[model samples]
Target: MKRIAVVGGGISGVTAAWQLARERAAGRAVEWVLYEAGARLGGTVETERRSGFVMECGPDSWVTEKPWARELAAELGLEDEVVASNDAIRRTYLLWGGRLVALPGAMRMMVPVDLEAIADSPLFSEDARRAYMQEPERAAELKATALPEGRDESVASFVRRHFGDEVTRTVAAPLLAGVFGGDVETLSVRAVMEPFVRLEQQYGSLILALRERATKVKGPKKSVFTTLKSGLGTFVEAMQREIPPQMVRLREPVEAIARIGGRWQLKSSRGAEEFDAVFVATPAHVTRRLLEPLDAEAAELVKLEASSAVVAALAFDAERARGMEIPEGFGYLVPPQTAGEDSLLACTFVNQKFGHRAPEGGVLLRAFFGNRAAGTLMAASDEEVISRAREQMALALGELPQPTHALVRRWPFSLPQYAVGHLDRMRALEERVARLPGLRLLGNAYYGVGLPGLMHEARKAAEEALG
Candidate 1:
């Protein structure tokens, strides 16, 4: 049997192991061993049940449009367990000038093609609106050469150039902050939000591209995001169950890796193991530490930049929640420029948006904190964070009542920031890693920092390892 070792037990690592197992079962004689540094297998993907609330420590849902995660779930017999967002109450908010204002409808993140919605939104000032209207007439100039023959300009530069400063501050900054937990000024447009950037490049204008897109799709619009019926952790747990217990090692942190005698030798705190192939699925930082001796350049590239984040969950009585007057919708996102006293990047109305997230007459609210501009918030004590969250909840939802239960999860350097020129760095790393025949790296740092994107990398890594 060809011995293979999979390092890091996160979703990426577990999924890669499962895929490799399936391939091995199909006539390839392979022995697989999966190692997780942490006690639990699910890395950042975690779900905690406190009182009657289901609190998601990391990401809550995966983008369904990106099919890798969903496809993997189905292959694992979790198709019936899938759940979609509550479209009936699908709405988001923006914190503008110390106030939580409803984000305009038909506006996906920062791309605003709906003039009617933009005109009606209270989030923007008259001057901001006037400036936004002049976007179509703005002169188009190539800021930098495309990364891969046709892509160029960072997300910040793109928004500033096309939509003006108001749009970048009011719309783009918050969206990017929420998604990447990074500063908009440094994020790469092509690396992070390439789809919208591509649309603008193709059509010459965002508004024009959106209108053309709306005209092409002739059916009832579908919600863009989704999760599992039980929770996203269900998917992770299922994958864990599929892998053989003997082959899986939890609470085993890998200390280092080296190429020994044409085979990879993995050293963990417990002991050392040699394998014919190795897949490193930890975060870029952890991956860097493990690969430092094997490849210095690869390690350096993985240590580029990352952001800290904190997710707080607050539970309140449903009656008290209803009285708070939170508008009917999913949640809200606060643009960095306008965030004030009780400023938060985004708030998820868990109970209202997902069923069974809370018990009867109880509401669950999740608030996200920390980004490049708001890193101090990540270091604040839980009491301070909760107090600030309650203040914002009272102002935005009018629910000043004390929370029935509260939970906070802090992630320092949890999110990798894909800044300008990140794609070039990743491409160079990939080319370098390709030179090592049996070595592979898979994680949010390479492709995207979302569930689907991570799953995609896992599947690709598994296929490559098996081949």
Candidate 2:
């Protein structure tokens, strides 16, 4: 029998192990063990249910365009549980000058497909609006100046080149911050914003590319995001059922891994074990530590900086919700310039964003603190976190009634910042890993951060390992 070891039990590790289990069931003569340092398997992908609210403690949903997560959900017999974000009234607000300003409709990130929508918007000043109008005319110039293939730049430079400084600061900063918990000045344009980069390469002007694509594509659009009806917790639960309980080693932290002759050796709390193949799926920092002794160059490649996040979820009952005024949009984002210590990086009006998240009359609000703010609050008590979140939300939206239930979750160094030239670094890392036989690295740290991308990578890693 072929023995394989999966270290760390985040979504990526779980997915890899689940695939191995399927291979075993199909008579592949394989046996595998999943080692998770934490007692729970899901890592940050957790959900809490109380008083009819399906509250997500971490990531709420996956982008719908990526089909890997949806495919996995279907395979797990959760097709019916899959739900789409409510896009009909889909609106996202930006906190500007102590007011909520709706992002213009028909936008792909900082690029606007409908120029008329932003022409008079308060979010952009007269000069910024003019920059939007002049982009298409400057398409030829932009195309001429587009970086050659394989070269990289920061997201700030890319957005500023097309939209000018004001739009990049006002619109792109908070928007990208909400998604990546990263600063545009440091994040890789080629790594994190690949689609926009491709658009730049092909059409020069992103606005033109989006506009032309909109005309060519003919179909009803899928919702921007997708999730399970009950909560993402259900997805994790279903995945756990596929793997035997005995095969999962919870609370068994892998101390180190070494190459032993033709096989791999994992030293954990239960002592050392040899495996035919091994998947290192821990966080970037942990993975770096484990690999340093075995392959220093590979370890250096995995040494990416990461950001933390804090989530405070407040659920208000129907009666209390009725007395408060909530906006119709999904939620709002706070730019760094306008944010203070107690300010939120972003907030999601859970009930409005998706159905089945809250009971008919109840309201579910989630406040997020990202990057440095999250680092500062990592040691804070739950009460301190909740109080600050509530105070910030009340300041942004309005006076809020007391919540029926509230909870706080802290994820330290969860989001890995894809620095400029990240792809080049990852390529070198992959080459170094390939030199070591029967080894694969799978996680958000290598490729993409979203669930769908991780799912695809995990499945592929399992196939390659067994093959």
Top-TM-score candidate index: 2
Q: What TM-score does each of the candidates earn?
A: 0.92, 0.99
What is the Å distance of residue 440 in model 2 from its true position?
0.8
What is the C-alpha lDDT profile of model 1 across 25-48, one tens digit per residue? 787788888999778888889888
lDDT of 2: 0.91
Candidate 2, which ten residues in sequence have the lowest lDDT sum? 335-344
lDDT scores in order: 0.78, 0.91
| After superposition, candidate 2 runs with Cα above 4 Å error | none
In angstroms, the error of model 1 at 174 is: 0.9
Candidate with maximal lDDT: 2
- lDDT, candidate 1, at 261: 93
Given candidate 1, what's the lDDT at residue 334? 76
